[model samples]
Target: MKRSGPLLTLVAGLLFALFLLALNATTGTRGASSYGEESPAAPAAPASASPPATRTAPPPSQSPSPSTGPVPDAGYAGRTDDDSASVAVSLRDGRAIAYFCDGRNKESWLKGDVKADGTMKLTGRDGAELTGTLTAGERIRGTVDVGGARHGFTADKAVKPSGLYRATATVRGAKLVGGWIVLPSGRQVGILARDGKPSAAPAIDPSTGVVTVDGRRLTARPVAP
Candidate 1:
């Protein structure tokens, strides 16, 4: 067989190309190779970047309601009056309500304690727990659920142990009724007597006969007006 130089060269080139392809398969590596075919680098895997850390923010907190403005003290006692010509709590649900009355008649007056920290619970004769809070500026305010409805009230100035008073005396056909009161830091004493007999020491106010070291007073009245 006679060999053509050009034909022989063509055959040599094909063999070289096949050999390179085989070599690439054997290498199995990424990046550029001796064939200069660019290899594609296995698509680079996209580098993954981690989504920029997500940056998720937290939810905001809730704000309190704007009911009775701001309470300065949050531990104030209050006093109020009712339409029944009697004294009632001048505070409720942050306003005012009927205070403890004298036998529900609304006559005379009555007093009770509204404690701080919302623990002093008041119950009606029907035995319903009263709900309230003592707040600033010397006021007690909160809500009361009566008849399954909410009612509001608040007190301003409070009474320091205020109530009725009586005197140690007796008159024919006279009431001769009296009472007394002592403040948180004040002190006074009572002396009982019968038929002008000194059964006990008479309570005497150094200054005003009505006002003693206790700052409370006594009075006598007509039995029938």
Candidate 2:
């Protein structure tokens, strides 16, 4: 009976040890599964988005324009359309003077102002009238009235020697008023009027503007209005 009791106790201890081993194996399996299911390391934070690109503008310009106006002083001389008369016009300090002559009995002296637009209207003795415009080419293009006649003409710009001249004096008992139109060709078309009677004028020293009328020396000066 004693031997039987000791054997039975040994059998019981072996059974208990087998049960503990089984429980430890189950716990190890559960721990491995938990580790595999852990959420994937949180996705790396997305890089911050970049700011939208911006634009800039440019600057402005600063400059001036040009000028357009009339000339201050000028002179012009030419002949009538019919070539029957010679005309001379002079401009000085905004004033204008014109002379018309056929170098015979027809003659007139006119005077007026040169307007801002380069136009002129002049009146003279015996109903004589002159109207003209100064062109961009510096030429005087217009019409003249003399002895009740209207004539068209274009006078070119005249330099120093090719201009108008006048001489006034009393010769031997008669009043002499002479006017000369010295042309660009050095030709002179003039008349010496004695007491209102017109006649051919003597030749003049153009450089000196000196003329001897009926043996009396006189200075024919440049005349302007």
Candidate 3:
């Protein structure tokens, strides 16, 4: 009976130890499963990173337009208030070249600076002066004074066939000068000078810039400034 009691006690102790080992294994498995779940949460960090890329997309929309400027670089032509003369102006790099003529014995080639505020004043030979404001990129309104005669004018933007031209040559010991302005509607006006004496000018070929005055052949070149 004593031996049997001790054996039973030993068996009870062995069973208790086995039960404790099983419980430890169960706890270890649960801890490993919890670590795996937390590792998957690390991928959620990349999902949060995606919003910064979206934030960078709005800057291009705030950029300025390519066409916006203080002045336009083109040609402008218009008639004077009296309808007896015409004017054309071309601008580039803040400088301007202009032509004024009556198509008969009255003309001037004016050159000057274009101010930041779209104002300009140009002077030429024979006491001619032009003062104007660039009302817009495509329009100008001003007055021109030639030999004490003042006239108001308005000019519109010129394109293609409507631009400025010039020709210069010494013919028979005389300094001959010619200036032409072609309107956008293909109408033309110009002036001719001989030894500083003005006269009615002639028509010019837009494609070749060729014209003849007083039987002299002259090549008129496009003037951008």
The candidate that achieves the highest TM-score relative to the unseen native structure? 2
Q: Could you give candidate 1's per-residue lDDT for residues 169-188 as a string of tens digits?
A: 44443323332222122332
RMSD of each: 16.1, 12.0, 14.7
Give lDDT per model, in order. Answer: 0.37, 0.86, 0.85
Residue pairs with backbone overlap in model 2: none
Q: How many pairs in model 2 have backbone atoms within 3 A of each other, for residues 3 or more apart or on separate chains, i.e. clashes?
A: 0
lDDT of 2 at 149: 90
User: For residues 58-163, what per-residue lDDT tens digits would candidate 3 score against the true structure?
Assistant: 5556665444357767789989988888899999999998988887788888999998778899999978999998865878899999978999999998877787
Cα deviation of 52, candidate 2, in Å: 48
